[model samples]
Target: MEDFKELTKAEEQIMKELWEMERGFVKEIIDRLPKPKPAYNTVSTIVRILETKGFVTHESFGKSHQYSPKISKEEYKKGLTGKLLTNYFDNSPKSMLSYFLEENRLDVRELDEILSIIERNK
Candidate 1:
């Protein structure tokens, strides 16, 4: 995959809704948002921006357009993860794992689970 492009927070929010819906109209997307909901055109413009970024596409239903993600969430994630590995870890899984371990975020059970995964993969 080509290096993934970063999305602004707004674009990412809309994309998350689309990913969950599989496909939806602009209003449908806006409906899924929390109480201080955005204006219809505000969401519509962002969807168009996403389309220009090659992250989305739409089909016409008369005057209305039903939007959909052109890329799967998993594919986008893989690209971003690869970028992170290359930029910060020299593309080394061991280096990435080491950094996470040093963060002290994992509990003993999580560490044991990771070790089990390594053993199974080996």
Candidate 2:
């Protein structure tokens, strides 16, 4: 996990597709994408990068490959948040929460619900 590197936007886009599919071959992934899907070589290159990052792996089945996530979605999300905090929030959860609460435009009712969640957790 320590060896894992943050994904670029292009890599993240491909990863989102793999996350949704749970597992998929190259063609399946490309077909699932919206318009302007990445070229086969581009997607393949990103997939290999994910593999090197330890986020994904593939099983060999004859001539085709069945790719699957090596890490759970939750784990990947945690990694993303860690990056966000370190890069954008100066690693301060307080600052991040402050910015998010003020900038995200949550209504009062939504804020109350979120507060309730925090209270319940406590």
lDDT tens string, model 1, 31-55?
9998799999999999999999999
| Residue-level lDDT for 108 in candidate 1 | 82
Off by over 4 Å in 2: 1-4
Error of 2 at 67 (Å): 0.4
lDDT of each: 0.92, 0.85
lDDT score of residue 10 within candidate 2 = 82
Query: What TM-score would each prediction reach against the true structure?
Result: 0.90, 0.85
Candidate 2 structure quality by residue, lDDT tens digits, 21-43: 99999888889878877798888
Q: What value does the lDDT take at residue 110 in candidate 1?
A: 90
TM-score of 1: 0.90
